[model samples]
Target: MELSPVLLYGEAEGMVRSLQSFPLRDTGSGGWLKQHEYIEKLNMQAILNASAGQEEMIKDLLVTHGKVSSLIRELITVEIWKQKVFPVISQLQDFQPRSTFPLYMVIHHEATIINLLETILYHKDVCESAEDLVLDLIDYCHRKLTLLLSRCSAGEIAGQDRLLPSSASETSSLEELKLQAESLEFDVALKCLSVLRYITDHTDSLPLSITTRLLNTHNLPCVLVELLHSCPWSRRSKGQLQKFESGRWLSVPAEDQQKMTKLDGQVWISLYNLLLRPECQQKYNIDGFTRALISSHRDPHRSAAEPSGATAISQLFVSERTGAPKEGADLRAGSRSLGLHYQREFWEMEGDSEAPGEACVLPQ
Candidate 1:
C-alpha cells in the first residue's frame, strides 16, 4: 500500500525558501519588494490548501519551519505601516500613483497573515510555536477588539450592511483605497475574534503571561459581553433577520434565524472555556456585573429545543446531569442548589415575562 510522503514533498521547501528571503522588518529594499508578493502568494496558497483538507502540510510549514512568529511580525509591521505610512502617502500631493492597488495590498496584508494564523492556530502545537510572541498576538487582538468596541460605543462603527460607501468608485484611488481598508475592518475584527477564541481553546498549553494578559490585562470577557450586546454581525432589517457572511449581509431563513452564527458560537465557546475551565475559573473574577449579564441573558420560557439562547444552554446542561435523583434527595433541595439557582430564577422571571414589543435589555 502506497502512502503519502511525510514532508509534503516540494511545497514545504518552497515555502521555507520563500520565508528565508522574507524580510523580518518592512524596510523598502529590493529584496523586500520582490519577496512581498511571493510571501502573499505563499500565504494564500497555504490558506487554500489548508481549507481543502490538506492542513498537515501547511501546519508543518508554519510550525516546523518557524513561520508563525514571522507571520505575526509581518502582521504587526503592516499594521504599523498602515498607521504610520499610508496616511503620509495619502496626504502627499506629489505621491500620485498610477493605481492604489499596491497600497490596498499593503493594507490587506495583515488580514491575509491573520487568516493563515487562524487556519493553523487551531492546533495546540501551533499555539505553542508562537512562544513568547503569543503575548504580542494577544495584545494585537486586544487592540483590534477594543478599537471595534470603542467604535461601536461611540457610534462611529461602519454598518456591516454597508461595507462600502455609496460613492465607492471602480477606479483605484487613495480615497477609494481608504474606503476599502475601512470596509475590511469588520472582517479583520471577525478574524480577531476567531484568533482570540483559538487562544482560549489552547490555554492549557499557553503560558501564564498569555492567560494574565487575556483575563487581567484586557478583561476580555467584559469586552466580549459588550460584543454580544452590540452584535455587529446581526441586524433587524424591515422585520427580516440579516447576518453578515462571506463579506455581505444576507437574509436568514426563519428556521435558521435562531441558530448561532460562527461569530456568536466563537464568542460563547470562548466564554465557556474561559469561564468553566478549573484553572480559568480560579483566576477569573466572576463579579456582579459579569454574573448579571450572564443571568439576564437566560430566559426560562426557552427550551433546549429552541435554536440558540442562554436559557437553552442552561436547560440542556441541567437535563444532562439531572437524570436520576439521589436517594432521599429533596427535589426542591435541588431548586436552591447554587448550580440550579440561576436556572430557577430564570424560570421565575419568565413567570412574569416581559410584555410584547418590549425592548431587549442587557445588564448594566
Candidate 2:
C-alpha cells in the first residue's frame, strides 16, 4: 500500500516525538563513556575524510580546523591566562601558520585583526590568552608586510616611479632616485611605525649597521626617514629639499663631502622625529648607546653626527618624555633639518603650537 503524505508526516512526527523522549532508560546508559571520546571520534573522522582531497581541501579544512582548533586553543589560552600563564603566548603563537595568505588578503585583514589584537593585549591581566592571539596577529602582519615589501622595488620606488613613472630612461638619473623616495607609501600604519622604531631602538647600530646600509642601499634610508617624517610620530624635514637634486655635489665647494655632517637644526630635528616612535622610545635603552663619529670619511655638508643621535643640535625634535614637542621649548630653530614629520595631520590648527618645521633630505 502507498503511504499518503499526511500518513508519512504523522509517522515521522510520532517517531521524532518518540526519539525526543530519550532517557527512556536506553540500553547503552551505563558505562565509563569517556565524555569527549565520542566528540574526538567525530572530529577525527571528519578530518580524515577532509584530508582525502589534499591541498584542494586546505581552504575548506583550514577554515573548519581554524574554527575548532582556535576554539579549543582559545579555551586553553584562557585557562592559561587565568593562571597568569604569560609564558604560553609563545607556545600558542607557534600553532598559527608561520606564513600567511596573499598580500591583498593580509592587507584586507590587518586592521580588523590589529584592533582585535589590541583589545586582547589590553586584557593582559584578565585574559592572558589574549596576548598569544595578539602576538600571533602581529607576527602574521609582519610576515605579510615583509613579503609585500620584498615584492616592492625598494623604499625609494615611489620616488623613482614619480621621476620616470615607467620610463626606463627616467631611472638613470638622480632625480628619479629622489622621486622614488617621494612616492613611498605604507600598506599598514603600524608597520611603518615599526620600521622607524626599529631604527631608533637600534640607534647604537646606526653608524655601524644602519649607516653602512643607508649609504650602500639605494633610497632605503630616505624612504624610511620619509615614512617616519610624514606620520604623527615626529616632525618632517623642510630645508633638506634643497639637496634633492643629484648634482648638489657640483654646487658644493671642491673640499666638502656629499653627505652633510653639520649637526644643524634639521639634523637634531630629524633625530627627535626618529626618537618619538613608540617602538624606539618604548623598546630602547638609549643610555648605553654610543655612536662613534668618524668625521673624516663623512661628508662636510651634514654633520658627522653621533650614530646614537640621542643628543640634539637643536631641541626642535626633542620631546619632554611626558608630553609632545614644546614650541621654542629650549629647542634652537634652524632652517636646515633632518627629521621627518610624525603628525597624521599635515599642519597644526591655529593657536595650537606649530611643529617647528625642518628641511628633509630629498634623495635625487
lDDT winner: 1
Angstrom error of the Cα, residue 15, model 1: value is 2.1
| Model 1 TM-score, all chains together | 0.75
lDDT of 1 by residue, 227-313 (tens): 887878877788998887766788999887765566766676566555544456457655556555654563222355533343233
RMSD of each: 10.0, 21.9
Q: Quick one: RMSD of model 1? A: 10.0
Q: What is the lDDT of residue 193 in candidate 2?
A: 32
lDDT of each: 0.65, 0.30
Q: Candidate 2, after superposition: displacement of residue 18 in Å?
A: 33
The 10-residue segment of model 2 with minimum total lDDT is 288-297
lDDT of 2 by residue, 27-60 (tens): 1233212212222333333333333422222123
